[model samples]
Target: MIAHSVEDPLYYLHNFRQVLQWVEQRYADLLDDQELAFLQAFVALEQSAQALMVRMVMRKGELFRSDRLDYAEIGDTVRALQPLQALGWVREPEQLSLDQLFALLRKDELAHGFAGQLSRPRAAKSDLFAQLQGLALAPRPLAQWFEQAPVGILQWCLQPLCDRMRLLFFGNLYQDWSDFVLADLGVLRFEQVPFSPGSRALQQRSEVDLAMALHHCTERLEQGEAPAAILDALAQWRSDNPWLARRHGRLLFALGRHCERLGDWDLALTVYGRSNHAQARIRQVRVLERCERWAQAHELAVQLAAAPANALEVQALQRMLPRLARKLGGPAQPRRRTTAPQLIELELPRELAELGVEEAVRQHLAQAGAEVHYVENTLLNSLFGLLCWDAIFAPVPGAFFHPFQAAPQDLHDADFQLRRAALFDACLGRLDDGTHRQAILDCFATKHGLQSPFVFWSMLDQALLEQALACLPPAHLKQCFLRLLQDIRNNRAGMPDLIQFWPEQGSYRMIEVKGPGDRLQDNQLRWLEFCAEHHLPVAVCHVRWGGPA
Candidate 1:
């Protein structure tokens, strides 16, 4: 059953209440006094008052003009807001800056209110604001700014508190109240995994605060804050929580990139050195090379090459080591190269170009005895998702914290596979006993349409599933799945665009299509190399627009 329907006028209120109740029940100990009081006072509010507060919380920005808010379900907006205002949850803004005032006022209102200041009354709002910049207006209340203001601005003061509750419930700030509405409306769906009592995302109050701090730091970085300042702020934080630590690492990595763009090599080196992100070390090497520190670059590149983190790192080192060696006046290192995949050259009618290269290729390949489909990254990932549904959705502590998650929280963590090694082994064991086909089919039938981290329900139907099972060898599937588990964050993508099955012969070939002038991406190259090493039937299909010569 759905959580809440949009047909209900109080759907948003219901969703908000659900979050509050969830947080209150699961994270009571972690809640501050203010948060606990909010829960208590919110329940005591009248239905309209609660609804009004939720409407404001869901909307963008803190300030809302009273006249702009009109809800039919809540009889009077002002009346509904009174209880909230009395509780200090909503208040008239004590002051607003000129920019804030400009944001709140309409162009007509600005023109009408400051007639003498605006030399060109018909000028754009931005130009009007620019002309008034010389006045050097100080921030003041709406009343003090204008003699007769059309509407009073009300600010939602408790947004941060509400946001804390949301963070606790959703595990991240990216997914907001709209997620609940989307789930309710059936626009999005998630698997309902049972949660243990200790399955919450942030276990301690400190962790919650740290997550919020990292979020704010990210915002400041995006707003063009100096990298040095953000780095200083980050250096003060330390977290044992791996999830939060990963977030911290990502922020550092982003700051490092920003520094690189600004040509701040020293800062970028420091930032990259501090990050544990997968690509950070490679970036550090590149930065060293760029700054002409060939010895240091070569030393680090050699260390990384000795124990590369993943395929991407290996791919990068192949290019870096040779260049670094040349710069350091050392012997030229023999670069490792993979044999290119078998090639198919096509020249199709220009009229067929509109169908897209992959589609055109699929059409050309499809025949009386062959079946072709544009599967891309979906088919293999979906197969793996279906075959290992239990392992992926296991009820491990801190994994399935909420019912709305499509996959476990640590699906991309370094230890994701290790934590569920036994479970995955059991799941993959079906291959040996010749039960994997049935297991995959059963999952496809039973768990169809449920959200998953890997499965693409919209793409994988019964026909494709059967054909893949019939043609692709279990050994081949196992190899690909193992590679996926090696580094899911990077390896989940870059699969061939199309696959053709000769069901009669129990054989299939994966095809990576390249239109004229389009070349293989790095990830695609990695996948092609992997397939070649495994002796998997794969090819690169190159296409030109004109008719065959």
Candidate 2:
């Protein structure tokens, strides 16, 4: 755990220093000359200066008004900034674009600066900016733009370098310095996995660069950049790192979806062809079929159907192959029928609508012997998380890089289970010996509230855990857990909404509740089918509101 003194004024600075030290220790070899120089120079700075620099970096945007940076601890903000400016880490830009000028100045300041030019001085700030859009204004310094402007904008020059250091420390861009503060404040807690010397996410500097490039491409795609251009940019790079490669494939998949949405079928097909994402092939088939390329679609669909990737692909192919066969004027492929789960039909009073369909059903089912709880995905997932705590948080080389991770870095990877097979086997082995119940209970008691990809601490309680452990058979749990491990990302969800436990009988039934006009989603149907196939007791409950009439 990260030690932080909240009462200390320099707590944030302490956290920032810790990150730099961590990155320098683990990723020293991967650090470039600039990063190395920054690290060396940063520690030499006065505490006040370092605190102000972290304050600026942690704040949003590159441009910041000096007046807004008034920190009580860092007395004389301008004095603290001088060292940073001298190091070229912070700079006062000589020229600012119209947008920058507009961003920094108030509406009154803008009106004051361009007193004669504005026709509507009383308009909103956005309207005032629109009023200036027509002018062919060139970039100029703050003084040149507005002589009476109270503060100058300072740009954090080394944000990229700092971001690289941050990336090294956390292994991702989404988590920033605030995570440290959050952890310190007890808003977040993480498992303290023992990280070995070899444990780190990126092995090389090139991987770091590749990850950043992929992140940039994703950002551009999100910002409405042309998919073809982004795809062209993406074509220039390839990564040997499985994690980075997965990121590349996911980006390609996204771009393909973007193209399909834009009606660029050829471009979508081209993007999908370049991608190795699990669903990319199916997407290509769908796009081809949409374009009326029946022969090509059928050819790919036939190939996919012969050896489907997973149950999801098989499900899609079952529906798609027959449709493609019809389109290509071939004999209709026999549709594989699945045995649906047992159904329960109910008509409750209209006033029960406030409790929701699942809750209403739970109330109806709850009696002297049976008790129902809305478990959904939480119960099973939490059980899996508790039992497999040792395996999931194993100190594998690349599995765990940082202390803040909720799960292993490769949690969603294809080789997630394969990499930690022995550890998972050991965890699952306890089930056969009737030891899993105790192991799960022990883990639940000890590791509660720690961050986990599976455990929902808020949704689980001791009573629920007791009931589930008592009523749910070990064999049934093993089956569900195995299926969950088969496709962790997709199979983690779509569980039945409510679980009715008969503790005395040592039995339980999962209920998938559906209100009027509600239908089972593909994932839900897949779960239901899996439950039926494994002979686990599950039912689909269709509910309707019945009034006094």
Candidate 3:
């Protein structure tokens, strides 16, 4: 019998898949389009919940990190609710205070007996979503049944977010909410299931499954298992499960890396060739280089450099060329990148130089309600970060745009692009208001704690975030958003030095600080051009160091 730990994260993933299948098979066909809308909303929330849990667990055991997931530290359902909130998936509660409750109560002798009195409840709580979650377990017509339960207000409020949800996830089962009862929302699937003997064996049989093998490999790697033993075991696992292995390209790539790390160049080279990952092929070249197969490595490197697939690939080839040339005796190709910005220089009062130009400008912006913050580095960067977050990442899934582990990597596929663009467009509607502003503040809670991998979310404080969200024009930020998110790894840098935000006017400007000789960087120019294209206000504050000239 294959032995497996009962606590593996795959166990949860397996169950999450079960919920999806249960909903599709049992509920999808039978339900009316309205009920199907509810069904789809339910799946969006839980599917994302499951994805978050699995990502957290797998991320803990990735090769880059040494620490393992503390399963005991796994949080409550509310934690799952938080991510859903990011995508307009939350049901806000309306807590009735004592006076409000008293107002709702029927007139009674006891209530009217006292001339000057007020009624108060011993305990008050907003439990609408919690109550609705409990009620959804039963098979009933959601609208009629909820109205009978007399919570129509909650259902009414649910409509906006539900609409937003359908918008965010590419138009769920139907275009409109019909009045129908759902056959099953799979609430039971949300509960934990104890691992049985059969299931336990299933989770442990890495020899039979590629995902299981991956989980095991990651765990062993994190545990600092002997590399040879790990490699040998994975080799056998792959040989035994060739069919499954063929479907797991990433696993093969990872295996190649492990072998390369162990100095098993032949195994690494062979596995890397078999791995269908573009990066793996690049790795194979490096493995050949390590094995002193200089001619083959050099030839491969030259061919790859001629047609580099991505920025990372281009960089890898460029770096390797010089080293390879040192051995093979040839001149390496030098890549030139020209990214000059539209330069406009300004002259500031020489007396201000004593106070420092950067400081003087920062103080000037602060006088106009642009609070200087220690965002990524400064107040302007921090504000821009939040402005970007409110405009893009908060509304979309974290997995959708992150570089290392982005979701739905069909970047070229029209359907995926259209869906992403739709969400971006819907988000732009909130440009001049406080819509989802709080969610923006809360969505990156993990990042603020420094426990998340998201690049831009965690850097701003509430003060800066509030100011940024209130001040930045949704139109200008929206215009600049996609490019920044697409190339977030590099394009995130070079925001202007100061922002003049006016909350009352819903207006802001990007001010790039330039001393006598400094000019705008490429990323900054990109931002400036986007602003100018949109007819948004931006300026260059060229502060030269000198006395009054």
Number of the top candidate by TM-score? 1
Q: For candidate 1, lDDT tens digit of each residue in 42-125? A: 999999999999999999999998888899988898889889989988999999889998888899998988897788989999
TM-score of 2: 0.91
Q: On a 0 to 100 scale, what is the lDDT of residue 228 in model 1?
A: 94
Q: Candidate 2, which ten residues in sequence have the lowest lDDT sum?
A: 180-189
Please provide, for model 2 over 317-363, each residue's C-alpha lDDT reduced to its tens digit, 9 standing for 90 to 100: 88998998888788987998889789999999999999888888898
Higher-lDDT candidate of 1 and 2: 1
TM-score sort, best first: 1, 2, 3
Off by over 4 Å in 3: 1-210, 222-254, 274-282, 290-295, 302-309, 322-327, 340-374, 377-480, 483-549
Evaluate model 3: give its lDDT: 0.48
Clash count for each candidate, listed in order shown: 0, 0, 5
Per-model CA lDDT versus the true structure:
0.89, 0.87, 0.48
Q: List the residue pairs that clash in candidate 2.
A: none
For residues 427-494, write the lDDT of model 3, one tens digit per residue. 54455565646545664453353212233434445665677768765556565555454444444566
Deviation (Å) of 246 in candidate 2: 1.6
- Residue 384 accuracy (lDDT) in model 3: 36
| TM-score for all models, in order of appearance | 0.93, 0.91, 0.38
